[model samples]
Target chain A: MAPKTAPSSGTSNSFQSLLKSYIETTSSRLKLIDVFLLFLMLSGIIQFAYCILVTNFPFNAFLAGFGSCVGQFVLTASLRSQVNPANRAEFKDVSPERAFADFALGSIVLHFFVYNFLG
Target chain B: MNLVLRLSSALLAAAVVHAASLSIQNPQFKITAPDASQLRSESLSLAEKPEALSLGPSDVLKLTFQVVESEERKGVQPHQTFLRFYDEATGEEGVQPVRVTPGGKAKFELNMARPPTSLPPTTSDPLKVSLILGSSTHSPVQYELFDLYVPASQPPPAHPDEVAFAPRPEITHTFRPEQRIPAKAVSAFFALFVFWPWIVLLGFWFEIGPRVPHLFSPHILPFTASLAAFEILLFWYWVDLHLGQILLYGGILAVPTALAGKQALAKTSEWRLGRK
Candidate 1:
């Protein structure tokens, strides 16, 4: 195994190929969804860090912010998976439109709970 | 009726005879120092008051008197004989009973060092000394004897609970300090910092440029508008609307949204299948 190639360079090359393949194969619609997912993940990380490093004096507001990010990310991820053509065999009965409807309803309900917790 | 009136009149006459007035006689007083030397000796007059008498601390005062009927000069033992000491300025008074023998002779001694509990608390003001005599068969009589000057005494000890009746000191309440908040500048920095993700999200979305050709179609527009309305309703709830009002409005709006979403999704499903 060690004689095959330089280990660090080989690992980096594999990682680069994987990223290139993902960007080339994934659709623009899926990439748009991935961007939203990234935004939610980053927001949650920032909020959690602020609570830990700065102050969670208004703990409810922190919970609301972090929880909304997490909840929206989960709903969006499920919608993405259900709409994904590669997962067609698993979610045969779920149409992309139906998945979007579920996402919209779930997001609205999550937002209501989040805003209630905010105060 | 005539017999009853006659009997009452006779009884009234008997009562009148029995009501002869009583008096005191040979009243004399003397004060002596603790060493047995006499400080004052005087025979009290019946009509006019004598000069005010004063005694020092640790002195002893002795008084002698006899009770008798005014008409019969014979000594008579009265049922009650009292010596009253009254302070005119303070209205404080003390009554001490005097023991009398069968022969109507009474001797009273006031030892200043061992003052009786019945002695009213005294100040520099004088006490008016008097004698009161009462008997069943004779009329009662009171005689003002003389005024006495006693050394000033400390006022009586206050009751243990007396302070409860007095006004008390005002109460002060201490409260905890207000909770601290992060500095405004730091908060503003974080607020702006939090928005960086939005720029990243919009940038990625612009790069992707996902198309939605049917988003404004009649079937999908109502569904999209209703979804936006739901978001607006939730935002309104955060700003001013109560939970109950938001829920009611949400429930009412949900009917149209669900119908529109079903119609839109069904049309999209048809188009997708036809395209495939």
Candidate 2:
């Protein structure tokens, strides 16, 4: 147990350093997008857990909630990848402004379908 | 014409001779038990009926008679000999043919153990029995014999589809139970918990503080406003607006949004290139 705790604490220390470096190194614009992505993923996981732990009687509302989270997460993730400076070589044809436009369009379409199922 | 007139006259003479009335002679009835012991014995009068005869479940009733000419007392076979049993209360009747020998003697046996199918549906009331004899050469004769009190017959069998015509039992319906909501405390807890992501998002965004210098610019603001309008329109669609209205409004809104998006993206591309 003593040896196991030593390795576990070391891993957590390294994880904390990694997080600090990421916060310091990444651009604020990318962090903003990452925060929104984190929000979407957390919201999606909560909704899914609620469905599994509790009742899904109003299944359509659950579907709208969960589907919107997943759909928006996908669109936001793609936007993040396209606008990321490190991935500029991979997405040279997709500019940050174009990616934002695509995200806005995809979000509107996703919201339309989500609202359709909200009943 | 003369031969036809002679034939017609001869037929009229034969009809007047053949009009002699017929009668029954020595009509008798005997009811015996299954073991051949006599239960009842009587002679039926041609002018006056005998006492009503009763038969048990396994009784055998034997009736013997002879059809004869009333004036000559000569036996004559009838072309049609029938025994009629009638129920006056229910108006139900059954005609059973009695086989007559060529010498005018007729014997009919009613075995209670195996009653004839020709018996009508019966009750406790007595049935009026009558004998009828008809001959082509002699005039017809009918005589009321006597009443018979047999055991009441079993009721008629019900038709296979009889229940279909009867009033049916009431129909009942079962329905699924209504959906229920979770406890208010649980619901409120989940509702508040669900909004934690919003806190995380806002708190992190505040911490990161990304700059958006051209967000409110003429080239970018119109595009942002149109996108926001699309969201508001969708919310309105969820509240009350129908699909057709939403589609029409969205189509009209799309044109301006496309124009504004092209202008905004083009300007942003120029800025990006200039910074590079």
Candidate 3:
């Protein structure tokens, strides 16, 4: 049992190394997406921190700030889905143009509601 | 010219109507003099004639004196002779005598001057005078003698011809107790719903659900539910107590809770992928 565990452990370490290398070697587009997601996430975090620090008196402002971050995330996710080779099953017929249109529509609707909420 | 004629005609009609109404409402009168014995009794009590000599209706008298001084100066004698005003309505008598200045100038500091006790020879009917005078008989004495015509003081008109309208008073409003709870609940619910999508998308962007697996792992369901609960508690405490303090406390709790949620979600997502 110990000899079997040793081989399995070594394989697991190698697998982890391979996964790390694959992530590192990913195209610049994927890296850009990662960076964009990080930017959006951090913006949202800062907004939440602001909401916590400042009284939520201007809740509409908070909503707008937070909503923009959400908008970015949704748009990025849609971009990822449309561009990813692995996501072909879901987005086989959808073009980047169509994805962008969906993102734009969704963002418009979100911002409209957010604007109303802010007031 | 036509407009001017119309305006003038309207004004004339209004004046005529007013005059007719005034004549129709003319006041009636009565006369009754006090007993002569009562007047004598009142006069004997004081050295000079009472400063204010109150005379009633139908009261009459005769004055015959040769004034070496001018006629104007004769009437100006201080408190020498004057008619005292008496308000029957109040029964309050004048406190000062009415003096007739020699120059026919009459003044009363505190009361109306007494009318002259004499009537001119030219008049046969007895009449009373309501006169007020002041001191300094430096000029010819000139007496102002007029009949006392005390009309019955009519009470204020029952209804004024012109009514003055006043603005109605404003009604104060107060909120009911039962309504407060639902209002607060609705507000909290709305606040959560409005911000829900934003927070969710923010979570996705941060990769919070993928990074922290232990605290928020297993599912995003519990974290979402916990947040909802926290929001409810926060709103309730805020509504029930000092909002500032509640918010301060909420902020303190939010920091750790948010971090925990992020870590849990991240760890959970990572673990799932790792397992796959």
Stronger candidate by lDDT (2 vs 3): 2
| Fnat values, candidates in order | 0.68, 0.81, 0.00
Tell me the tens digit of each residue's lDDT in model 2 across B119-224. Answer: 8878998889999888877778789999998899987677899999999999989888888778888777887899999999999999988889999999999999
> Over the stretch B173-209, how does candidate 3's per-residue lDDT look in tens digits?
8765342223456546555644654565555455523
Q: In model 3, where do residues sit more than 4 Å from their true spots?
A: A1-19, A115-119, B1-276
Quantify all predictions' global Cα lDDT against the true fold.
0.90, 0.91, 0.48
Q: Is the docking of candidate 1 incorrect, acceptable, medium or high quality?
A: medium
lDDT of 3 by residue, A4-118 (tens): 9998999999999987886677655555566667667767876776567544556677787788788868778778778665675888687444454455446544544554455
Which stretches in model 2 have alpha-carbon errors above 4 Å? B1-163
Q: Which lDDT tens digits does candidate 1 get at residues B1-276?
A: 999999988987898787778887899999999999998999999898999998889999999988877888778899999989999988889999999998889999999989876778899999999999988778788999999998888886788998899988789998987656888887778878888999999999998888999999999999999999999988889999997899899999999999999999999999999999
Q: Sort the candidates on TM-score, descending order.
A: 2, 1, 3
- For each candidate, give the interface RMSD after superposing the true interface residues on Cα: 1.1, 1.1, 15.8
The residue-level lDDT of candidate 1 at A116 comes to 97
- At residue B85, candidate 3 shows an lDDT of 39
What value does the lDDT take at residue B157 in candidate 3? 40
Per-residue error for B209 in candidate 1, Å, reads 0.5
